[model samples]
Target chain A: MSARTYLDAGGRAPLHPRARQAFDAATDEGWADPRRLHAEGRRARLLLDGARESLAGALGCRTEEVHLSAHHTASLHAAVLAISRGRRRIGARVVVSAVERSAVLAAARFVADETPAGRRTAGLPDGVDTVGVDRWGRVDLDRWQEAVSRRGVALAALQHANGEVGTLQPLGEAYGHARAAGVPLVVDAGASVGHVPVQDTWDALAADPADWGGPAGVAVLAVRSRVRAVRAWPEDEDPWFPGGVSVPAALAAAAALQAVLADRERADPDRRALVDLVRSSVARTVPDVEVVGHADDRLPHIVTFSCLYVDGEALLTELDRRGYAVGSGSACTSGTLEPSHVLGAMGTLTHGNVRLVLPRGTVRDDVERFLHDLPEAVAEVRRMIGATGL
Target chain B: MVDARGLACPLPVIRLAAAARAATPGTVVTVWWTDPAARHDVPAWARMRSHTLVGTCPLEQPADRTGPSGPQAWATTVVVEGPPAAPPD
Candidate 1:
């Protein structure tokens, strides 16, 4: 018999071979601080610059625009703070979609929570304006336009695609409104960059290395030349700021991005078909299961659904015991024991949520095995809850 | 009274539903549960069964219930009126 299928790419993907090689090579030769004036430092600096330039090529931005950071969450918080601070003189309102990543939403809320109502807080945006999303988790474009058009808007945030449901947002419309308002648009491409084509129009973009099979602990924050984004932490205090990016992780990330982009065209359709199969099969086999997100327009490798009678945590545990690894954006899994904000915003069933993200090189057989095991797992969870009949 | 504590998710609601069905008319069924989902699921179940939600409050550890390490902790106490308007089909 073949090996048990591993279907939990949404949690963290297996590292790509090229990324592994690059990271291994970098640790030996590129460990020296790039800011030092020694020969070893020069060698590390060269590797770091090369990685930045390579990532710049992939992202359609200049190497100088890319600032490597610790991770996606930190990068997003820094970017939001910097961009909002840079435009503080113009306004103090930062706007974001309701379905944005928790990092983005939290950053906005942090700033809003710190200050008094209608009062400008130094180094922080005053008020946060949230734009609602449609039932499919797409930002309501009309509401977004209205919020971004407000005279006191300092910055606006919209993700290229939602991480939980895989729904792609209308970034172009959000960007157009931001441009008209003379505000910088920050796009979190953490979920879409390596899997799909990310446009060059957004004023600022954030991406994580783990999204493309690279190692964790590093992310890229790229800002357009025309956009003014000041670093929340100065280089003197934070050595890893601006040009002090981790050489090894950055190099590995660049290699991984190149590898994924090279074979994306060939692998996209195959992976997408597997995802579609899961979406259809789950709905077909699992009673009262609601598949969330756009039917046609979504990330090629991600599918999410909510089972009505199952407990999210129990169902996750059952799948794990059956040798299938999956993740949930549900409240029970989120440590808060509340429903998924993405599902809640869409007015969809938030309980028993399951998200499946296929990693690169996933075969149809593996996906098929997962599909075969899922209904049984759901049924087992329901039975445990004394909900066997339903 | 149903002590559904230490159980996760739909179990609490299922037990509550059963208790609500078994209780006589005008009697109140109090369900002590640990799972947070009961905050919403229990209320929804009551409304669906056409029972009145007497109230819901934070529950403290029961005086008689002691754990091996210490006293047990359960967070939610959901109260519902008994005798469903319609059969629990």
Candidate 2:
């Protein structure tokens, strides 16, 4: 078989050429301890500082605000916990959008469970209030504002974009609401940092390298300068030191982010057009499909759709067999196939789901071929499952 | 008993709730669901319907036989001690 066109950037990104070179160089020269005061340590610290500055520049924040971590999930856990703890005196509640990443949800559950027994309420046992989303997977602003404005909310989480459906959240509006309510916003930009523009409007931000063709095992957590927490990290421990992320990985991530951002202005239009091609082509060719997400307000690189009466896994297999690598967020079981919470909240069909994430520099030819092949894949899967209403 | 092993949320709870409604009082019904959300949804459904959640046992099955993202499936059993306070209108 010939090479397959990889379209799963949400899962893992193909590293950029510059990122690979930077990784090699940094690994060769940055192995010393950055905490030491020796000459070698000074050199290591300089590299670390440079990486932080580059990442901070990408995120539109000061260098001192950036803290490198081993993974985006860790940063999310730590940030949410820290922010929640910082406001513990004011309130124990943590407000979040219904479609947040699993890590955020898990961390919220943990925090709620840790609340003192005397402070727990019946419906608010977890002290976690979830704001719902619209059918397009975008946060419902009115509902979100109401949840954030609740009397005891400590922190609120809203991702810049939905990794599953590619819906872009209204970060500015959310930030305003959070500010008015005296709550801090923690924005997870893992899916949008390298692919689209990001801002430092939130009180905390979490971004990973995998979304922007950077090396894995490194993520950046930027907490605004004045935000301090007594329990976010142990008092004796360095805030960024969670077993120490690889200096080389951090440098590579920073380099990849800067390289992507530099070309974003020139490349965004073409990238958006390619993504639109997928959206349009899939709709035109595939039968019984409902195109998901906000067509105009979504990420320019990702699109998702669902087919009625079809099995998502079967369709995914057919697409893979046809030399197109895609992803599915469908929850299908032989007994009762369910869609993801995002689709479920939107009340959309969950079966035969397909999420296509075009890489930073995807070729038009491959996208065209994928468009040409997707209909047949869906049809075959539909036939295999004996689905009607084609 | 309902085997919801491959089903996700709302589905597992839906099936289990239906089984509880149809079952005789004081009978235990086992539901096998794969989605992690079922762990919460199932118990919540039982509580809302005034049923007793006996216990849940995690199923150890191979990943392939499970859904696409292979992981452990939950086999939870709940006992129905009374009828639903109000049936769907």
Q: Which number leads on DockQ?
A: 1
Off by over 4 Å in 2: A121-126, A232-237, A333-338, B1-88
CAPRI level of candidate 1: incorrect
Off by over 4 Å in 1: A1-4, A116-125, A237-243, B1-8, B11-89
Best by TM-score: 1
- Superposition-based RMSD of candidate 1 using all C-alpha atoms, in angstroms: 5.9
List, residue by residue over A200-223, the lDDT tens digit for candidate 2: 678889998988899888888999
Error of 2 at A318 (Å): 1.6
Q: Model 2 - which docking category?
A: incorrect
Model 1 DockQ (Cα-based): 0.19
Q: Over the stretch B1-89, how does candidate 1's per-residue lDDT look in tens digits?
A: 88887776667767766765666667667788766566655665565455676556667655786666332434433334544333222
What DockQ does each candidate score versus the true complex, computed on alpha carbons? 0.19, 0.04
Q: List RMSD in Å for every model shown.
A: 5.9, 9.1
